[model samples]
Structure formats: C-alpha cells, structure tokens
Target: MKRFLSQKINSIILGILVMISATLFLTTNGDATIFHVAKTGKDSNSGSEISPFQTIKRGIKDLTAGDTLLVHAGTYAEHFFSWETSIPNGKSWEKPITIAAHPGDSVQITPGGGKAFFWITDPQAKYLVIDGFIIDGQNQAYHGFKFQSGPTHIRVQNTEIKNTKYSAILVSIPPDYNGPSPNTYHEFINLHVHHNGSSIKDHGFYIQSSHNLVENGIFHHNMGNGGKFFQASLSGVANYNIARNNVFHNNSQSGKWSCGLILSSGEGNMGYNNIAYGNYAGLCILHRVTNARLFNNISYENENYGIYVGIASTENSYVENNTVYKNGVYGIFIGDDAKNTKITNNISYLNGNNSSDKNIGLQKQTGTIISHNLTSDPLFQNAQEKDFRLKEKSPAIDKGEAINLISKDFSNTPRPQGASYDIGAFEDIPQIDNIPPGIPQRLRLIN
Candidate 1:
C-alpha cells in the first residue's frame, strides 16, 4: 500500500510539471496572445478566458509584443497606478501591444486615495496603445495620465479625461537626460478633456514631443489653456507638431493670460480648422515661438486678443483666413518684438472694449504685412444662436486670397467656390441658380 501511494504522488507531481511547461510554451510561442481582466476575478488565477485576472496590474504582467489585454466593464479604483519598466517594447508598429475595453463594456479608472491615477514610464515602452477608457479625477488632487518618456508611436484614443488637478494628459521628457532620442511620434485622437486644473497650473492637453498629432479633440472648461505645446531649450525642441480640427471653448476660466491654444517656444507647429471661444485669449503664439502657422480658425467672444502673436524672436509666423469677432480686446494683436509676421485674408470686426480700440493692434513690430482683411460685420446667419456661417450678401464671401497651405474650409469643404476663397474659417457654399428667371412664358422659344 505504501509503494502504491508513493507512485501515485509521483504521477501527480509529473502531471503538474507538464501543465506548467505547456503554459510557458503557449505564452512564448503564440502568434498573438489575448488576456482578459474582470472585477470578479482573482489575481491567483491564470490570465485566461475562463479564469481571468482581477486587477489591471495583474493583467498587464508578462505583456509581450503583439499581446492585447481586454478589460471588461468595471470601476477600477486605485492610487498611484503605473505601467512599470517591465513593459515589453513592440518589435514594430504592426506588432503593438494594446490595452483596450472589451466589447460592450465600460472601463473607468478613478483615484481611490492616490496622488496620480496612471503613470507610464520607462524609455523602452513604445508602440503601445491605450484606448476607450474613462479616467475620472473625482475632484481629487490627482493626475489623469502622465507619460514620462516616449519615442515612436504611443497612441491614446477615444478616452475621456476630466476633472484632474494637473494636466489631463502630459508627455514630458526629462529636462536633463542623456538618452539617444527624445520623445517623438505620439498621437492623441478623439479625446475629450474638460474641467481640469483647479489647483495647479494645468492644461487640457500638454505636449512636449516632436512630430506629434492632436486631432479631433474637444478641450473645454479647464482652468488653464485649452492646449499647450512647449519646447524646452535644454532638450530637443518640438517641431512639426500639428493640432487640427479641434474645438477649444470655455477654457482659461481663471482670467489669466492663457489662451484657447498656446504654443510657447516651438517651431513648425500648425493650428488649423479649430474653433476658439469664451477664453481669456484665442490662439496665442508667444515666447520665441517661430515658424508657426494659424489658419482657417474662428475666434469669437474671447476676453482678450482674438489672434495674438507676442513676445520676442517670433518670426515667419503666418495668421491667415480666420474670423475674429466680438472679442473684448484687439481682434488681431501683433505685439512688440514680433518680426516677419504675415496677417492676411482675415475677417476682424466688433472686437475691443470701446470705440477707441481698433481691429488690429500694432506695437513696435517690423516686417509685418496686413492686407486684404475686412472690418465690417461678416453677417453671420445668427449671432445669438452661434451660427457663424456666412449669408449670401455677406462681405467676407469670396474675398480672400488663394493660400496653397489651406485647401479645405472649417467644414472640410473645398475652398474658392466663387471668384476667390472666403476670408474666414468657413467658406460660403455657393448658391446654386435653382430658380430660373421668368422668361416670358407666353413668348416661348421654339424647342
């Protein structure tokens, strides 16, 4: 009987060893692995379809390239959440690791008692995608998301980030680092960031990375600027970044000098087809930022300068084809030390505090061109209803020069329907001659 029992025990141990080996083999050699996480799961269970992991921390363990973690519907509360150094880098963009919400599920991340909700660190974490998550700050002093170091394609999409004390999203590389590459090639898409920056200096979205794209975003109700792009002099300067087709409204509620969109000390940055309203200022390009372009945007009802280019060393900056109306200060403010700036084909009217103020404010600037702009009311379809579209008899219709840089209007429509392009964010769609003139019916011509 004792011999039989010992043989049985040996068989059981051998079976467990075989199982372990099989698991390891599957994890390493699979084409792509998919893990699941649920609220009813336990950390001790294997990350499988049936026995899923409990916490996001456990689900992300051993995440390799070409792996995906699908988080089911649940409220994940945590303090100081982090994706640590063990995150494996993808071999290429085609093999990125994805952390996303499961189908027909809602995933939310809120701070339980921590300072920051999520922190993504390490230089090796590249080609990672985070999508379809709601990060709620809950009015606590917490940061929504922070990326310390990045390079080559870290994407965050379809995310709602709100009510954070600091910036809703920040990509910051260390000021004094000896890394081979700076943060570059990041993208933020279809994000809604609101009600952030109550305590500290916070932006709805802050970027310090080069060649990044922030598109189709809604930035509103933040205490600081709607979006800020800054380039540090010590590190590599941000260049070739683009912010397109975004709406910036009701930001900078603190009455500071923050604008709807501000680019400080950056080069080759472009902001186009954006709408800025109800902010302290609108579209401020300041602090030695050069080679920036602002075109085909609408700035209205802002408290200060509608389109402001200020500070020193600003040159080669072009502001064109924008509509500035009903702002509290100058419609287009070109401040001191700004050089080689071109302001053309914009519609500026009904701005400034009183009759003494003008549509364009110029102070100690050189090499500037102001031409082909209209100061009359653009005859919006309905001003109180926020319909800024042009009517048939409006003066701004087809009154702009042809700018090759901008081919599409605010509605993404092709420009220049008539003699020339319209002089605003919106291009007036040409009226079709639908009704024929009453050619005398009685005197009919031979068919």
Candidate 2:
C-alpha cells in the first residue's frame, strides 16, 4: 500500500509540471516579457509589478518585440521623441509590442509644447499597439498623436483625444520618402475625438495612407473638417481605405471646410454604416475619386446637403440604402462631372429649403441610375430625442432591394428581418409586449 501511494504522488507531480509549462508557453509564445509602469515607481528598478518604472519613456526604452508594457493609473506629462529617439527597437510583425493601461484604470497623457504627445517618426516602425489612454492636447499643441512617416500595422483604440490645436490624430508619410512600398494596414477603433483644429486648419482624424480602417469612432465639435482620408502626394496612392460605423456631428463649427466626413482623393475608398449630422455637408466625395462605394448610412439635420458627390473626376460610384432627411438644402447632390453612378434603395424626406429644392439634386449629367427612392415621411421613432429607428408601419421597413455587400445593420443586427431588406442604417425589429392576455369584457355561452 505504501509503494502504491508513492507511485500516485509521483504521477501527480508530473501532471503539475506539465500544466505549468503549458501556461508559460501560452502567455509568452516562448520569448516575451511583461513590464509595468507607475507614477510612484523608479526607473532604476526592474520593471515588475511591484518595482514599476516611473515614466513611459523609460518603459519604452527597454521594450523589444513580443513584450507587454502594462501602465497603471496616473497623469503622464510628456515624452519627447525626435529623430534621435531610439524608441522603436526592431518591432516585427511576427512579434508586436503592446502598451496598454491596466484594466479599469485611467491614464491621462498631456503634452508640454506645440508638438505631439507621441511622435513616432521612425520610417520602419511597424506592428505596435497603443490602447486606453486619454490624450489632452492642452490647446498649445498641434497634434495629440502623430505618426510622421512609414508605420504599418499600428492599432490605436479605446482612447479619447481632445482640445488639440490641430488634428487629434495625424498619420502621414514623409514627402521625402523614396521607398518603393507604401505604408499600410493601420486601424483606428473606438476613438473619441473632439474640439480640435483651432491653432491650424485640420481634421479631427487625418490619415494619408492606403488600406486603412477607421471604425467605431465619435468625432465632433472641431473647427476644421471632421475626418479626411487621402493619398500622399509623393510616395503612395491611397486605395481601399474604409471608414465604418462612425458618428460625425457638429464638426467644422468654424466653417473652414464644413464637412463631416471628406474623402479628398482616393481610389476604391468606402464610407458605410456611418451617421453624420449638424454639419455643412454630411459626406463629401471630393475631387479625384474613383470606384467609391457608400451605402447603409444615415445623414440628417445638417445645415446643407446631406451627401454631396462632386468634382469632374469622380467616376463609377455607388450610393444606396441610405436614409437622409431634414437638411436645410438638398438630400443628395450629384455634380455634373459624376459618371456611371448608381443611386438606389434610399429614403429621403423633409429636405431642401425651398420648393424647387428636390429630394435629389442631380446635375445635368448622364450615367446616373436613380430607382426605388421614397420621398415621404419615414416615420421615425423619435427625431427630437435623436433616435433614428423606424417606427411600426414605417415606409422604410422591408422596402429595399436585396444587396449582398453588407449583411448587417449599423447596430450589428442581422439584416433582411422580413420579406426583404430594410432601408436606412437600422433594421426595424417589431417590439413585443410581454404582458399576459387580459380577461374578456363579456363572455356569453353558446350551445
């Protein structure tokens, strides 16, 4: 019996060792390290949870690929990064670095001068994640987060950037870059940008890159434009950029460009599942655009046109399944130069200032297809409360032609809930009363 007990104890010990090895492999993927930073800690000590670093710069100095830097709750002053800064130490796509705030902790990052808080100027820096930091520009800086040139696979999310003199975030390639390739695959998600562009004319979020994604953001109360996506003049031609599920409202308040979302020049850029309001123009497809697709959007209550596709260079565009209303000017404006465009499955109502202002103001041009459009009251759930959901028996419900591009609504609900697809950014779901059946008023027995 004693021998049997010894063998059982040995088996248990081997199982525990195997579990420990598996846990370590999954956490690090073999060669990663974890570091910590806090306000009260010292840079001289080892960057562990107990002995954290004092500043972000100190933590960044020691970060390599596959490393994780966890920052605690505090107010960070600034970190100066110039051409001489050795911040990016060979971060790779296979092993990216992560810098994030602790769960449920708030980190406020404020800059000191007229520069950005985080100036990533490295031309070859790639695969970095910056998440969960509140950046305040203090009205003395030009940018909150600026990537000067040539950074790809960079993801910024769950952050609030406000009060900057210029744009809250600026990503561009340097004009002098002679590289053969373009910077690509940048993603911005869940960002809140507001009250910027007072010092210089800019957008809330300006990106000059190709194949980027700007999703799930709130941009408002800016002096210049809301957001601009275009190509760099020297190095690359931006293409296949997408802006989805964002809310742009009350932007361009000082009337510089007066656009909520503007695509200056790009090819195959897409703007969908977005909502814009209280601006001069909700969505503007400006000069030199080709093969652009805009659908499943809602634009309402703006000072001017809801959607304006202009300039002589725009061609082969598609605008469908949008809900536009209550603007002071026309609902959708197509310039004389626009060609090969398809405008269908849309609902427009109560737009235009005068009786001559039609629901759609199409210029004297050919190559335009307009069909299945309704110009009646869409019977919104509540416009006063800013709720754009469709009411019961709304004309917009299940009245749209089926399209396979987007299978979901703005709220991520599955589409085609009824016989056909619904119009606008939202799908109408019939509300059900959960109360039990009431008793009959009078019941007579029949034989």
Candidate 3:
C-alpha cells in the first residue's frame, strides 16, 4: 500500500513538472499579440482591431518581443518615431518585433519636420522587421529611415522612401559608438528609394555598416549616388557587403563624381546582376577598395564611364561578364594607381565619341589583366526596346571564362548551358525536349 502511494505521488510530481515546462515554452516562443493602429481609432482604447490606437507612436510603445504593430491604410503626419534601447528587443529572428502595414493597406507617412521619419538608434534593438510602408519626407526630414549605433539582424522590406533632405536610408556606426561591432547583417530588400538627397554629399542609400545585404531595390532620381557603401569612420569598415539584382538610374543631380552605385573604402564588396543607367557614372569601384567584384551587371546610357575603377589605390578588383554600351566615356576605365585589377569576359561596345575613348581605357596601372573582352556589337535581340538578351549565333554565347563564384546568370539561369559560360549578364538557354522517351512496351531479354 505504501509503494502504491509513493508511485502516485511521483506520477503527480512528473505531471506538474511537465505542465510547468510547457507553460514556459509557450511563454517564450508562442503566438505573438498583434496591435493595430488606424486613423479613425483612439489612443485611449486597447490596441485591438476593434479598439485600435490612433497614432503609430502609441502602437510602438506597447510592443514587446515577438509582437507586431500593424498600421492600417492612412496618411500619418508624424515624425521622429525613435526606437531606443528602452524597448525590449526580440530574442531571435524567429521572434522578431515587426512593424508593418496591414495586408492590402496603403500606409503613407508624410513627416512635416524632424531629423528622420524613423530613427533606430539602439544597439539592443536587434531582430526587428519593418515592412510595407511609404515614407515621403517632403524635403523636411534629414532622412527617411536612419539606423545608427550598431543595430544588427534588422530587415526593412517592401518599403518606398523618397523626397528626404538627405539619404532615404542611412545606416552608420558613428565614431562615438563604443559598441562591440558595427551594424551587421541588416537587409534592405525590395525597396524603392528615390528623389531624396539635396546635395552631392547626400545619397539614396548611404551605408557605412558591414556584412549587410541590399538586394532587389530600385534607386533613382536622387541628388547623389544611388547607393554609396563606404566606411564613415575607423570603427565602421563597410566590408563584405553585397548589392545584387538592383536598378539604379538618373541619380547624381548635383553632377560630377557621383555614380549609380559606388563601392568604396571596403574589402570584398560585390555588385552583381544590377542595372545602372542615366547616371553620372554607372558604377564605380573607388577609393582604396580592395577585392571589389562587379559581375553580370548591365550599365549603359550614362554620362561617363560605364564602369570606373579609380582614385587612390583600388587594388585586386575584378570586373567580369558585364554588358556596357552607349555611355559618354570609356566603357571600362581603370584610372591611375589601381593595381592588380582583372577585367575579363565583358562586352564593351559603342561607348564613347572617339575611338581612343571607346571600349577600354587604361591609365598608368600595375598588374592589370585584360582578357576576353569584346569591342564588337554583341548582337542583342532588340537594343532599341532595351531587350539585351543575345540572339542566336552571337559571339558572346559560350565565349566566356568560367567563373567559380558565378553559378547563375542575371535571369537566374544556370551557367554553362553550352560549351562554356556566356560573355555577358545573360545566358542563352537552348530549347530542349521536356517530355522523356517512353519505355519499351515489351522488353525482351537480349544480350
């Protein structure tokens, strides 16, 4: 009888422990509470859909880790919504705090006056996601979104930022920051940033952070470079970042020394599958940049060189498999002091007015390797319509040196569809039979 009583007691204790463990797990990683904000709502109400908050500030104040603030369709005229260290950060990417527009709702923020529409300044405000909002700064705010002091693992996606006094998006680790690392692993995806900067010092996106990714963005009509990636100070290195599958055009309204995209003062920075046109310069790898790689890009119709590698010790850079044409200056210009540069498998034709300035221009440089580049017309399918795909029997087809890092083309087609890789951004895919041959109806044993 005592043994039975002791077994019952042990079973009851085990059940209680299991229940406590489950409760803790749910509290840590369960479904998040979603707060709603609408213009018609009031701040005094609970932040539910039926009793929503009126302003974005009130919605943000109640957010915790794994919480979401969903703003409804409306024009919000507020500014300087600062997200500081007092707010708790999400524990991980899976439990990130999110500020987003409700699905199918158009959320526009027109800030009248402030430093920024949104300022993310806290190093501890990590693992946050901002999505699907439109910010029009009306040339009043200094920036649309400004991130500073090393906030990591943040994502801003599907947002449109425009008409700010300075950069639309600025990510910098200032000199005063005593953080452990510069802002790292942030992502800006599917963004449209345009018409922002007021001078040459400003830009569409000014990034001084390291290991960030900017992809699938459209940057245009800004006062400076469409995107500028460089170190702001010694503490912010801006190294190992990637900008891919973006379009940059019509920037540099201040004129001269600006580019559609500029990668400077960084090592191992890469730009691939991008299109840059109608800028002062299409693409620039400049100012002590090391191991910067530009591949599978299309740059044309710009004011100056399609690709310019210049100014103060740009070393060990690689420009490969890009298509450049119809620019005002040399298609690819390597200026003085650029060392150990490799230019290979590019199509540079019809670029400049004179023959001397036409395909490739090399200044006084050392250890520069230029090989397998084409100066002839690359036989586009339709140049007038801007269809840059190669036609059949084009010289660029299967005439490129195979690059180990590039496994796919601009259109995400697999490389090496023929004897070798294609020479430009596109790989011409040959037609093939989709249906397989049928098996024999009656197989006989024949040796």
Ordered list by TM-score, greatest first? 3, 1, 2
Estimate the lDDT of model 2.
0.76
Candidate 2 Cα RMSD after full superposition onto the native fold (Å): 12.0
**Quick one: ranking by lDDT, best first?**
3, 1, 2
Give the TM-score (vs. native) of candidate 1: 0.85
lDDT of each: 0.76, 0.76, 0.82
- Candidate 1 global lDDT: 0.76
For residues 151-210, write the lDDT of model 1, one tens digit per residue: 457788777788887788787767776554364788887777889887436889888767
In candidate 1, stretches whose alpha carbon ends up further than 4 angstroms from where it belongs are 1-30, 79-85, 111-117, 139-142, 177-183, 232-236, 354-357, 434-447
> TM-score of the candidate numbered 2?
0.84
Q: Which lDDT tens digits does candidate 3 get at residues 202-300?
A: 898988878889987788998989998886555327788899878888898635679999888888899998888899899989887899999999898
Query: How does model 3 score by TM-score?
Result: 0.87
Report RMSD (Å) for each prediction in the order shown.
Answer: 14.3, 12.0, 13.8
TM-scores, each model vs. reference: 0.85, 0.84, 0.87
